[model samples]
Target: MRSLEIHGVDDLRVVERAQPEPGPGEVQIAVEWGGICGSDLAYWRHGVSGTATMRHPFVLGHEVSGRVSALGPGVDGFAVGLPVTVHPARTSGPLPERLAGRDNLHPDLTYLGSAARDPHTDGGFAERITVRAEQVVPLPDGLDTRRAVLAEPLGVAIHAVHRAGDVTGAHVLVSGCGPVGLLTILAVRAAGAARVSAVDLSPLARERALALGADVALDAAEQLGQDVTVAFEASGAPASLEAILRVVARAAVVVQAGNLPPAPVSVALGPIVSKEIDYRGTYRFVSEIEEAVELLARSELAEGVISHELDLADAGAAFTTAATDPHSSKVVLRLE
Candidate 1:
């Protein structure tokens, strides 16, 4: 089987490797499609993510959907050839926190393709890979691989919206028009937000956001009036946090959903103190996977988010294009 190994910053190599066999309580998936994420681009460009860097050879994919090729011992109640989406979490220890469904806070949680691993596990940018049975969610019939590939990031959007409390008739602003940001737009719209706006540096991104139901798409640097009731900082840009504070209406909520490494930013203390803004943090999918999947499956159209598909062998090109091309939305690497 073929696998991708990250040797260093901005480096990826396709190499021959032994096919993995599923261990007990695990399943092997013949990867069908994997989505290149913004965090992957950050790791390649900066050589580090958050507080961790590429110290050892690492695999670089998390947004994935595949088919079950083999089942390991103790893994039952599932058939081979079933299409499924991969939930890339490595907190496999018998849970104290996550077992109750709050897996996001599991202390040993190591994300797929991230530098935050202890015994770093490989990801789904290859011919096949093995994962715990609980990490795979079976995709419903009639949902295309592209939509299944979206299950990971759209789940983030869903989590952020839920953190915003009630979006009904609320003025919402999404900072960043990347795949997750655009999907956040769609999610907020679907949740009945009366007014929604998006911000990005890319004109192409702004256009895509508008096409996908964003009421207004503006440049992040533009002056935002005091109308936004809730602001989602999804750009991962350091300044977007302060921007959210500056533009939001009094008593508005700000959900920092972007994976921003720690950086200092000036905030208007008066607004945060006087208006009592609810600033919250959100991570990956939590209790919203089923709803996000159902929404995607029930939508009448493609929802205008997934932009392109490339072969798994061209995963490097997909990352390059997604990192450099502002027009790129979700660049999915299609397998079988």
Candidate 2:
């Protein structure tokens, strides 16, 4: 079987690899679609994401969906050919007392496609792969692999919404209209936020945010004249985060969902002191992926997010488009 692997910066290759089979309490899947994530681009361009430097060649995907091909011993409630997505997290140890029930915050977590740890974990950007049965999630009925492929990112959006506290009927601002930001708009709207405003530097991103049900899409440089009760910083740009701090209403909730630079960048903090905003940070996700699947199965939220889909044979084009084209939201690779 052929798989996409990253050796170093600008060194992604499609190479032949032995097909993996399921182990005890595992599930083997024939991957159909793999969504290119910001982290993937980081690994491809700089051999690192945040501080997770690439140690060697490894598969490059976490957002993926496919059909079950085989189930290992002790696996139940799943059958061959069942549509599925995965949580992509494998907890290696116990959680802290204060962080109980939040598996995403586990100190010893191994996520698929992450180079965070030594002997980095491989991902599902291949024709076939196996994951522990516990991580495999059956897709909701009527949800195809194309949309289910977005469950991971949608989970990030949902988790960000949760971090922002209650947004029901409140004015929310999403600072960035990339794939994650657009999905954040869907999540906030679904959570009953009365108005959803999005901001992005890219015209294509701004336009797509509106198409996905944002009440209004603004340029990143503009400030919202009205009060923003909750704001999500989805652009990694430090300026965007600073601008958000300046405009939110007093005592508002601000969730940082985007990946800021690994190194420190200066930003104004006066607004936080004056307004007493609840500035919070959100990581990948928790058990929200199940909720994301249910939501995607019911709505067209992820439909407009897929701007391009290429076959595994054209993986380079897929990565190039995802890295260079701001207009392309989600660049998917059809592995099957």
The TM-score leader among the candidates is: 2
| Superposed Cα deviation of residue 234, candidate 1 (Å) | 1.0
Local distance difference test values of all predictions, in order: 0.81, 0.91
**After superposition, which runs of candidate 1 have C-alpha atoms over 4 Å from their true positions?**
93-101, 220-225, 267-269, 300-303
Candidate 1 lands at a TM-score of 0.92
Q: What is the lDDT of residue 212 in candidate 2?
A: 86
- Model 2: residues with Cα > 4 Å off, grouped in runs: none
lDDT for 119 in candidate 2 is 94
Question: What lDDT score is found at residue 319 in candidate 2?
Answer: 91
The collision pairs in model 2 are none
Q: After superposition, how far is residue 197 of candidate 2 from its true place, in Å?
A: 0.6
Candidate 2, residues 1-336: lDDT per residue as tens digits? Answer: 999999999988999999898889999999999999999999998988998999888998999999999998889989899999988999986789999878899999999999999899999899998999989989988899999999999999999999888899999999988899999999989999999999998889988999888988889635687489899999888999999998888999999999999898999989899999899999999999999999999898679999999999898899999988767998899988
